[model samples]
Target: MSITRRTFALGLTALGLSACTNQVLRTAPRGAKPVAELPADLRPTPNPGYTDWVQGFKSRAAAQGITETTLTAAFRNAGYLPGVVDRDRNQVEFKRSLEDYLAIAASDERISKGRAAFARHRTTLNRLESTYGVEAEIICAIWGLESLYGERRGNVPVISATSTLAYDGRRGALFEKQLLAALQILQSGDITADRLTGSWAGAMGHTQFIPTSYQAFAVDYTGDGRRDIWSEDPTDALASTAAYLQKNGWTRGVTWGAEAGPGAPAGRIIQPQEGGPEFSVTRNFNVIKRYNNSDAYAIGVGHLSDRITGGGPLRGSFPPDAYGLTKDDRITLQQRLAAQGFDPGGADGVIGSKTRAAISDYQARNGLPVTGEPSRDLLRRLG
Candidate 1:
């Protein structure tokens, strides 16, 4: 799955805040410390109800067959992360245009890197594809998108993040289940407690599999005892991602979809937005959706994979965005919005929730239609 702004933000925030713990663990290696005896510096600031929640969850986890040692190691210094709650409660608006998404997912630089990475790992990817019946480029596309070819695997402690979300009580059952899965991963000895780090939401490894996803689909591709997705080697993660897609119905030798011109073969067609490049997708496209459950994301992966494998860009021209702005114009709009103190997250030419909210507030104050779409008129007015 491609890392969206929300996931990227979650990763960045988690890593940024974990500086203390990372440093401490670097100097003083953690042993089998009891939850209470763990150093305060190792934990986030606990809320009033957090301790009780942990104790209750401890009992439940014990009942679920997680050993006492596993529970203690997993929760040694865990506490509620306020940032996780903020991210969960207010997910970034998922209004990025396909163009915006591709600008990051399949940028020229990214395509170059993807090609290099594909070439570098061709032998291993070939074997995996032959074994799994999933395409190598697709796996490479996911690798590029999820962690930029292993450039940005997150650094947050998975147990802490999931346990915090579990105790936070908003999505208690889901996070509790995830926390249990994390403990299981620890018990299995793939990765240790200190090294079991990932996104703020607990998506781990190269392709960002959550704890449950890892348990269900992770593979030991290298004949090693561990399905070590965190190591420098990307074989297991890529193989695991392929296994997942295969399990979910990736048709062998079938493409996800393709760009179509006028009078193209009729299938399940999706344009993403009005007057954009159209795709004649297949069941394989839906299979890609199981990875991220977003049309734009699936297309980005498919198209980028195609590009990585030497395919050209779409021939059909995308009409103006809903706001009557071209892709370049949208980039300008994002820059202008940020310049005016309305941060649309990053100036990546995407009109996500933050951008829409900022635009709405601007419109409400200035007597314009509250349409969240960016327009030439809005850009000029901001100017």
Candidate 2:
């Protein structure tokens, strides 16, 4: 995840925002000084409340076994970042249709990059797959989505961003814990305070593991004695992601999901948006959800992984989004269906599995082709 946008993928809020916190310079090596401060104009206006909070937290951190030296390094120049709070407050909810999401998640260019990355990391990925029972392509897919194959791991100062969120008090405890975990990471000598930058939300490294998750799942894959997820070499980060999946019950040899066709295996069918491709997903699909907790996100990972491994695109036709039908139109359609004794679960504008099932049932009852698509024509028929 990019720090400001995708950083929340490490299970922070359901919004995938405000997930982790730490501090290190982007270009500095371990133990090096944090680089040049921001331009005077860009510096956040000093907030005495934030300063007080940091001071109190410093005491608490010391109580929690964080050494003074580590705290000093982590807190140097740390302050509230208004941009972090802005991104958190303005997160778009369910804004992307499945088609839109898939187009970006598994774009041809991304697929090409993924294939090259897969081939490049074949030896290490193969070893990880053999050892951890997680597929290399899946790992690569996450790498692709989280940071564009390490091209954009975020440059936010984890300490400042995380501290600002904690001070913001919307999800104070969570951010505090992340802040403490970051301190532990620093104390462990894994990465220096000068080099610990990540997404604005603090999701660090190649696959964007939050601080706590990094502590639990990060591995020293190259025998470097440090679980360095932020470094240029992606081996440790990739291994850590595989380890995280395996630890969270990613089954060996089990497909996450497959495109639904005739005689597809028995599993939960999830079509994130009406008229989009449907997938019959397995238990492993749920496992993927442990990372980002979104059906669209999990499916994107699975499909992108498939493409990376030479699989084809989804074999379903989907209507383009952005016709005249708005959320109110969808609610009206649902209300009409329910009034006709063909309940569409609820009148929420969002199309979900239950809503799609109801649409299919309504279509079948009317002797129409069972496409499970919500359309103006269908709404007109119901009216």
Candidate 3:
């Protein structure tokens, strides 16, 4: 969700860690080769089984009313990009501390831009909120995160990437469906082949709507026949995201959450694991999880939403037992815990049940509060 290194490792592990077991696990290895510096065109190609899938995709597109010209042009020079697969597979290593993630994601630049955009489009956002029951700042934040307010919607062709992934056979069924959806969009003339570029996963536009999301939620806020999320106008994209959250049960009049102070009374702490960081999340927080099913992601959005609405940071520090941890600190704790045989079950860094259990075990052995938290004292003992 937030794309932390620890989360990537856990994702890889979820994909069956055996495939990646031979690779090194360190976040930063000494003398490692830089992947970005690798020569282009030296990567591997599809296994030849993908052509049939591509043909099927084209046929499905045609059935959906995509013009032959659009389909042909979109797929003409499209080929499997090994780099996309590599990125999709290799996973990230550096975990963004919560503060760091928020600082960048909701930075002055983003906030300044967001506020300007919000002010400029006050009428539109207001209408959208009234109609969709989703807040303006949340929409602005999504816009900021997805494409930096539409400055970088990616250059990779959506059809090509989806086709490649569909043909690759790893997640064929899923990608094939997405490929068809992309073609449907093309067929509808909502966007052209050249303008239909997006992330490797086929998520497009200012708010990174995958084909299905685009088809399901995209709007013609500009009164144009087509839903143009790729345009400089963010009205359609923001509206679409709002529609999505509203559809998914976003509650009106409720804030995501507030920064808890050190003296704040403990709310209903939902510990993912026995010794993980305690969170007092609300029902709306669960709604954010539906958007991206990760605790950190939900928390990030919640925290960012609060900041955009002029709220302060968390007042109380996280329970630290080992790793001198904060919210972000849990990611590294998870990784190190895994290395130490704790197996926190996919190091996405939100201290779930297994992580707490591991922390408790570590604390019991080391003579500390078996609170299973990663407090400063625990970090000192761990050190």
Candidate 4:
């Protein structure tokens, strides 16, 4: 999962150059105002074609029993945020090696806290497990990863973010639907407009549930007539996550998979592509994938859950050259390659086929192995 040189280059290309944007900032004039501080009216406007989308959102919210008072109160001062769109549209650089990803995502800090939380809330977790048929560790692992158990829910207003994304006309329909769901949540008095904040991409709550996800899966476990995923009490959020997995087909009792030790027989080895990484990947694992459709993410959740329950790290090893590279290093490599005209497509730090191809081309020209795997030796040549 290391970010290759090509991935980094693509990120830079997206920003109109193959250099680190942050570096450019450091060299800029000292008096320059930050992009985020510009006047509101001067900011990016909605695409004209999305007027219909706004109207549609209003209509849907009304039909879903969201009052006009709630909708107006939520969106009255909302404005388009082009920066949010830019951030969402940007591709992520998967530069963390499996070990690094696991270490951070399933770190000891998380495990210790998770164990303590489990002990304190054993009654609630056990009740949820029996009622919903979802394991406590999986729930806790997701809770830890999504917002560090509600310690850092994002500050972007869900209503405004979804409205802005909808108005931007790139996936307008999707955002519009989310906007309606958000209004419904407000109407139901589950969360007030001022408290409804989340990621710029519109996922909210301790578990980062999108508005649509809230509509479809939120649970009022405490029976207070509201599903309060954002409150200090995480009962609703945890229960909702469990319900989501259960509804999506979580198996009762199976591990996600463990690594086969290097010393094991050849038949025990799980190959990378076809039969790689002999993971147990139960039904719940698939449900986790539904939350974010990435093998790395699902693996992170599963592994973190195992760790919480006293499991250890993988015993087998990844490919020899696949050292976990940091995000910054991948960006550096991509910038270096693009400067030399290898054209890895932009400096995003993801090792896509183009990046691999660029690496192969660079290796062939330099009389190297042409294996397309990045290394310190190739980096020296590129430098």
**Best candidate according to TM-score:** 1
Q: Write the per-residue lDDT of candidate 3 for residues 1-383, one digit (tens) a residue.
A: 22321232244322111122212111111111222322352123555666676777677667766788877877775767676566555654334334434444555666676667767878988899898887777776666655666665655667767777777766677777778788888878888776776655666777767787677778887788989887767778888888878877888966555444353333444543334345677666777665555555566566556566676655544444345555556566667776777666555555545667888988787676788666655544454
In order of listing, the candidates' clash counts read 1, 7, 18, 18
Model 3: per-residue Cα lDDT at residue 208: 69
> For model 1, where is the 10-residue window of minimal lDDT?
16-25
**What lDDT tens digits, residue by residue, belong to model 1 across residues 149-205?**
777676667887888788877777778888898899999989889778776678787
1-383 per-residue lDDT for model 2 (tens digits): 12222344333333222211111112222222233454332235588998999999999999999999999888876777777777666654535566656655777777999999999989988999998999889888888877778876766667787788888887688888888888899999999776787766787888878888888889999998999998888999999999988988999998888889975566899888897778999998888877777788788899999999999888886664464566567778889988988867566555555667888999898899998878989889989
Task: Please rank every candidate by TM-score, starting with the best.
Answer: 1, 2, 4, 3
Off by over 4 Å in 2: 1-44, 262-265, 324-383
* lDDT of candidate 4 at residue 260, scale 0 to 100: 48
TM-score to native of every candidate shown: 0.79, 0.75, 0.67, 0.67
- The digit string of per-residue lDDT tens for model 4 on 264-285 reads 3232222333323555444555
Clashing pairs in 2: 1-146, 3-199, 3-200, 8-16, 22-159, 24-196, 25-194
Location of the lowest summed lDDT over 10 successive residues in candidate 2: 16-25
lDDT of 1: 0.74
Error of 4 at 362 (Å): 24
